[model samples]
Target: MINIKRLTTSDADFGARLDALLAFESAQDASVEQTVAAILADVKTRGDAALIEYTRRFDGLRATSMAELELSQNELQAALAGLPADQRQALEAAAERVRSYHERQTLESWQYVDDGADACGTLLGQKVTPLDRVGLYVPGGKASYPSSVLMNAIPARVAGVAELIMVVPTPAGEHNPLVLAAAALAGVDRVFTIGGAQAVAALAYGTQTVPQVDKIVGPGNAYVAAAKRRVFGVVGIDMVAGPSEILVICDGHTEPDWVAMDLFSQAEHDELAQSILICPDAVYIERVAASLEKLLPTMPRQQVIRAALENRGALIEVRDLDEACRIANRIAPEHLELSLADADAWVAKIRHAGAIFIGRYTSESLGDYCAGPNHVLPTSGSARFSSPLGVYDFQKRTSLIRVSPAGSRILGRIAATLAHGEGLPAHARSAEYRVDG
Candidate 1:
């Protein structure tokens, strides 16, 4: 008896209805933005004192000093050792897979002579380098995702980030061993038990104890998102992601139960998360809906799943798989699953999507955990312009240019013309100097 929306391509208003379903606004409250601005200003001025005070006021941790909140290397190692053998092995295995996959994405510096473009042997290329340091924020409390630790930290490490600092909230001074273990395995250089806007400020501005990071990455609540938005130019950010999304295109060949569970996987994320199904078979869509109603009650997060499905979920009856692909291209979902038997054939049809899961057996959840790809993806139609978090996110590029003496004669004249056209006398003069020398 879920109240999910049902639609068909034959409907005249199908396009408009679909747009309404996919629309999302990530804007924050004015009050939240103002509060974040104050907190950032306070942290920028007071440094460690502001961090300590906020940690006490917000997290209820009345620590005497900042050192007390910092986790030592020994503590991280002990957390890894304390886990059950099976859990430790699984964590290690996932880390290895993630690390191995990101190794291939590591960019290297390269240069080449522009002999074709210029006869004077002018050199032009690019230099790739990783950020010197990066800060990672993990949401704490009842939810603890060690997977996020590996997803965010492993890429920074693989990109050769010199120091990786992690901040997680420890309300009442309680910590998650699994989180610490993942941090240890991912080679995080530091750990602090602080969160919210204050943690972001500490990483962004640096305190007496916490070192400044070149870029900050990870997920958090509204305040964290607000803080990252406020400090964007000061530091690099991964993305202010929206709700989790999954668009499944089934060919009516996949099992009904499997399709139902696939929708649940994303709906379970939260109430605003979206789960949509596009199929040519109207009866198969009904079968999946029935399966959803029947299997939903068994889930521990049943109420959350129900809310998400009833509010944002949809089942669209398309003319065929080609129509399904066209609709999916419009959605530009964060996670896309091609549940067709010949999933690979349709891959070329998909041009947008943060990550693509091929085949019925390849559930989006696999990409979330041990799938060897970074689970952090662009959300809320951002896949149209952005991409999944990878080693490239933590790395930067610099353009390389060198002009030979012979090259300056021709290059200088071209530069001088452009500079004069732009009305910049100094630029033209500088290029003229190179030509004369």
Candidate 2:
């Protein structure tokens, strides 16, 4: 039997135990940071030469020039065309749903005249604009992530981003067709077969072939995360995501096997992933534990699932559903499932969560793929302040201010007073210059 932690809310040490479980040391390794810094500086200095060298050294894909590493539009389309009918249909359907959902999130420029006592007839508002170019880094070796292409690229496209350049490491010159196909379908402008810190650097500081992008988004290994962290101010990046997580609040009515499998879905992502179950029923929790024991041997990725469950997973018995919701707020999990009979009623109680999978039928896996919502959610308790990746992440908002002659006189005095109080004579004088008696 696997050893998943069990917690009871009534215990005196419950809070301390919960805190211990939630605490994950996220500091980057010192060696990884040092290596990333060196790689970033090298790429900034050598450009495409550094890229070629890194590709050969790390990915074992020997190439003479940058042109040899970039994939043509024809190749991308061919990948999409060659997919089996079912895979092709699924990709298209998921892409369409993701596109449709994000289209609603597009921000438009708006302005209004301010006719108040302090400022009369002053035009003030916000001008929304999309990023010029974005770089998407898709992990490409052992596993495939067409879903990530749709999640990251579609939002940028929906926000009217001009160019989307994708970089995926094709180790030993092997490419995942699904990723390329998704790129073609999502309207990516350019595709580069590069990986690791070098790919991030090339995108951040523009090489001979790869154009500089305003932002870089998508998932990668620790090297990529370290590189993104190092070059944050130089270029925008999506969050340095943690392992996958799922918090299921079942009222014990759902089938035990179903609950067990739901936990396994996130656990199979990796050993660091967390899967927690909070219910008011004790016997029901035991049934679920038995189900986990019975089902473990059947999974293809059983070792990973077992490790994740033993390390970070938990089965907590709360006082009631209300207590469960309160605890859920404290944890602020990435993916929360309300598996209660009255799941809709409890949604109001959940103020924090990257995504809430409502009802028993709505699996967390659906949201990861074709659920009409971006699966790139805030992880590691970041949902408290951050949000899921969307078109908003790709759009910039600029404040628009047009001071009329009458409004300038009224607003100038306020500005001058404040500037003088702050000991900024230049600011005061600048505002005074625009003021009239």
Please tell me which predicted candidate would have the highest TM-score against the true structure: 2
What's the TM-score of every candidate structure?
0.98, 0.99
Return the clash pairs for model 1, or none.
none
Write out the backbone clash pairs for model 2. Answer: none
Residue-by-residue lDDT tens digits, candidate 1, 1-437? 89999989999999999988887766689999999999999999999999999999998998979998999999999999999999999999999999999999999999998886565898888999999999999988766889999999999999999999999999988899999999999999899999999999999999999888989999998899999988898998999988899999999989999989999999998999999999999989999999999999899998999999988899999999999999998899999999998899999999999999999999999999998999999998889899899999999999999988999988999999999999999999999998888
Window of ten residues with lowest summed lDDT in model 1: 113-122
Off by over 4 Å in 1: none
Encode model 2's per-residue lDDT on 160-215: one tens digit a residue: 99999999999999999999999999999999999999999999999888999999
- On lDDT, the candidate that comes out on top is 2
